[model samples]
Target: MAGEMAAGLAEEGGSKIKMIVSYVDNLPNGSEEGLFYALDLGGTNFRVLRVQLAGKEKRVVKRESREVSIPPHLMSSNSSELFGFIASALTKFVADEGHNALFNDRQRELGFTFSFPVRQTSITSGTLIKWTKAFSIDDAVGEDVVAELQTAMEKQGLDMRVSALINDTVGTLAAGSYYDEDVVVGVILGTGSNAAYLEKASAIPKLEGDIPKSGKMIFEKLISGMYLGEIVRRVLLKITLQSSIFGNIDKTKLRTHFILRTPDISAMHHDGTPDLRIVAEKLADNLKITDTSLETRKMVVEICDIVTRRSARLAAAGIVGILRKIGRGNPGDKHKSVVAIDGGLYEHYTEFRQCLESTLTELLGEEASKSVTVKLTNDGSGLGAALIAAAHSQY
Candidate 1:
């Protein structure tokens, strides 16, 4: 199903894949310098960073970062309140920087990494299409997210300019490309899943009038971390309804939505004990379903394996689809290329990563597989935003 989804997304008028356009075209070129700020608003926690870049000579001079978790009540609250909360956090983080030597008098330039779907109008502005990953803000939908953040900054009395608005996947690409020119793909496989790749403007039929000088598009919206855990939860729900293997514990835990999170399922799948003790313990601890037999534990692990395997295999297909779309994985193609990957799922889940690589090898075959590599690049989302800010700063 994921492979089908990916393929459909690649097609010009493909169904199922939304294939939304990101209006960003500026990419980092290693020459970006000076002080920049990054705000990564994705998932349950948002991260803020202050980076000191010294062009190509010293690269990153110094960095400081802080993470702030949103209370459940804030996610669905008024947009002004939520962004105001974020602005307050940013103000506190900046004030904490004090009169350090790295400090400059210039107003800060910020790259806002909004990880939801947006109809981008420019490099620095976009309208939020909708919220995903359990976020449902009615007012934020269709509003200019950049303007919202800017207004919040004003309320905080912060002297800053919003230089770039980007998706996390796009930030990953910018950061990865800064380090490796061969890196053409940026993927996030953490709590959610998404990919951003360089697409030729000519190939994108959805783009109208005045194509970018780079003639490229950042393709996101499929094969990412935000939906993987939910997919696993759905499959598990189906299995519990159909099977007696789970036994008669209060179906309460299983009935709860998103209760069986990806990390819990991953820990169980990685358990290698002869009796699968870790799986049993995790099930009992998370679901409160104790008194499980070894056979039942085995069955639970099998279900996890099945779900994650599909996710991994489909991720592989998405990568392959991008390669084929860009004319890389074809016969006689020999140039080496790298796909830079970030996010928790790809980094921590050993089984999922291995399955993804192996499946890629299987699909690309021996020859073409040798020309492609998926390299893990950590913290690209937050840091990439700063890099983009420096690259596209108005100052």
Candidate 2:
């Protein structure tokens, strides 16, 4: 994986792992002060945030945020409709906050956290390379995402400038670095999995022209919340077709793609009842498989465990891969390398988080693992975007 990442960084195309440039040369220095906004659009939900910073002394003095779920239709809708819905949500959030949230008369600046593959043109603009995690807006592909949002904002009479455009992993890295300067890698394991890390500008071979002082690279992963449930569903479906463990059960719900969510699996996996009641409950509730035997419930839990463990182990390997790429995985490296992780999978799924952390430690070995730390930054991407906006503010 480490070698693949290097190859991806050097190659312009055809690499399974795309080490895309983030165009974020600078992270927040913790001295940025003022009011800033952040819009995080990733997966089925989007979030808007406003933050008031008081420079180095106080950090974030005030903050407000709102989360809006995108309708299923919007995920497959045209670019205009999706952006319009997002922009309308942002306008409402701004109006609800009123002028009191403003630090001064300066125009509102926003940092956009777009968690998708993008070919960045600059720090403030990037064209969508493609959509992931269920989004498939055909017209939006190859279009400048920042411009799309900007146009939508204009149509809604919202006055704001997008100062920074970044991936969620980049934002999480920025957020982590704000408090701990040692943080170098950021990983997101929620709806979709991806990682971003700061790399020496000179190391990227595909980069053209003069190299900046710093560079960041992002890559995607398949083992994440968005696909975990579907994986479990497929496994169960295969088992049902091959055996009679389910005993003539209606496979209608099981046949449905994405019918079982990560949360449902997490709940079932964490069931501690003597009878594995939660497992049976989830099977009944989500897959409509009721009156499950204790043995069958155990099998279901085992499946969840197997799937979750695989994902966590793979995620651990990914982190180690990044660490190795950056020359920080060796036992001789005494520097404290902190990996900032965010997303619902890492934050809310206790078992997944534990398995990931433990697997990471195991992969690093006891001696080398002592110098590494994985910190959870809940909603760090959103706050980091706001901070980046402040850092790049036109004041």
The candidate scoring highest on lDDT is 2
Which 10 consecutive residues of model 1 have the lowest summed lDDT? 211-220
CA-only RMSD, every prediction: 5.0, 4.3
Regions more than 4 Å wrong, model 2: 43-45, 68-106, 129-139, 151-159, 209-222
Candidate 1 lDDT, tens digit per residue, 1-395? 34434444455445445455566676777777777899999779999999878878778888899999998988898899999999999999878665643445777889899877677778888888779776888999889999999999999998878899888888888889888878888888776667788766665654653212211212222244445455566765677788866666677776777676778878889899999999888878767878878887888888778777788888888888778767776667877788999888899888889999999999999888988989998887789899888888765
Count residue pairs with overlapping backbones in model 2: 0
- For 1-395, candidate 2 gives per-residue lDDT tens digits of 88887887785653557677877888887898878899998779999998888888898888999999999999998999999999999998888776566766788999999877777878888788778789988999889999999999999999999999987888888898888888989888898788889888888887762212212232232478978888899999999999988889889999999999888899998899999988888888889888888988998888999988888888999999999999996887889999999899989898888999899889999999999999987676799899878877888
Q: Where does the lowest 10-residue lDDT sum fall in candidate 2? A: 209-218
Best by TM-score: 2
What does candidate 2 score in Cα RMSD to the true structure? 4.3
Clashes of each: 8, 0
Clashing pairs in 1: 191-225, 192-224, 192-225, 192-226, 193-224, 193-225, 193-226, 194-224
